[model samples]
Target: FTVVNRNVVFMKELVNKTINLAKLNSDKIPFNIETISLTDEIKNSVVNNQVLFEENDIVVENHVIDEIYVEADHILLQELLNNLITNAVKYSLEEGGSISIDAVQKTGSSDIIVSISDTGIGMESSQIKQAFNEFYKADDSRHNLDSSGLGLNICKRIVEKHGGKIWVESPGKNQGSTFYFTLKKVKKEPLKQKETSISSI
Candidate 1:
């Protein structure tokens, strides 16, 4: 009875917070999205045939920075990113696995994709959907965890709100998961309107 009551309260809080975010109505905008750079790549690990990387520290992959920018709520973007990373850390193994972030341009489209992947305890099918529910918890659909069960939902809203899409996929339970969000590429210049004469003079 007590646990159920607490879950109810958590759900309410999430709804309220989401509503506020709607009022503020500021989108996340990112600039300087490079592709030819890995901000956090290993330098002294490769020798003959081996790769070594460290965990716990944020790794920035170096690659050719793509020429594309997105307009969004900066703060919301951070919140969404932080939420995913936090979840990854919260459910990660004691030894830790890996948290990777990458950005690339999608072919045949003017959009950029930012992906965050983690090697942590993956969710079951039931838990997967509940992860975004206002009060959907693994056990009770609501708990006293740091999240208000609105993190992913907020992320989904933010992405779609910005004319983008967000989704999640995993191998299965205890495997791992990757969360990806996309931002439409802004054309540097738009074509100008043409004036047509009734007849060519």
Candidate 2:
């Protein structure tokens, strides 16, 4: 019964990914871009996946500062994070490792770079190049049956849709990997000044 339940869940996820990929290719996916707090968004994503983290005995650290804001589709951004986090968990060490998320805005740049790093089964130079390609699995033996191989591809599409770029970097096999993506930054609005009317008095 447990095996059957797992298969059913996998099938549902596979179907969802297929539909989302088709929609993305056709440019039919809707995006509602708005100013969002990067730190808060990451926190929300982590909290949403609390069960998965606990089950895998993995530790996640979110280091994104609260002051950084970005223009993005909230739902799509959450999905992107979820995909990356799940991918990290899949390749994590047998004894469990750590995943860290951080964001930085370079001086004079309008984009904020967000990185998700993991102490997992890292990839090689060749694997990094094709990691975002649809159905491109780095290592079949390392991946579970539930992986549809479309998560990173979907992530790439989502980042590009937001006028950003995404890439992965790793030292080597068994070292670790880090996924980085950029998003347009939004400045906070200045406080309005109150008017002082004393002439009437």
Per-model lDDT: 0.54, 0.82
Q: Highest TM-score among the candidates is held by which one?
A: 2
Using alpha carbons, what is the TM-score of model 2? 0.88
Give the runs in model 2 whose Cα sits over 4 Å from its true position: 140-145, 190-201
Q: What is the TM-score of each candidate against the true structure?
A: 0.59, 0.88
C-alpha displacement of 155 in model 1, angstroms? 0.7
- In order, what is each prediction's RMSD in angstroms? 11.5, 9.6
Q: Compared with the true structure, what per-residue lDDT tens digits does model 2 show for residues 20-139? A: 777667644455677777888888889988887887788999997568778777777888989998899888877788899999886798989999999988999999999999988786
Off by over 4 Å in 1: 1-68, 138-145, 187-201
Model 1 TM-score, 2 decimals: 0.59
Residues 20-102, model 1: lDDT tens digits:
45543443322222221111121111111122233333233323244444544444555555665555555555555666666
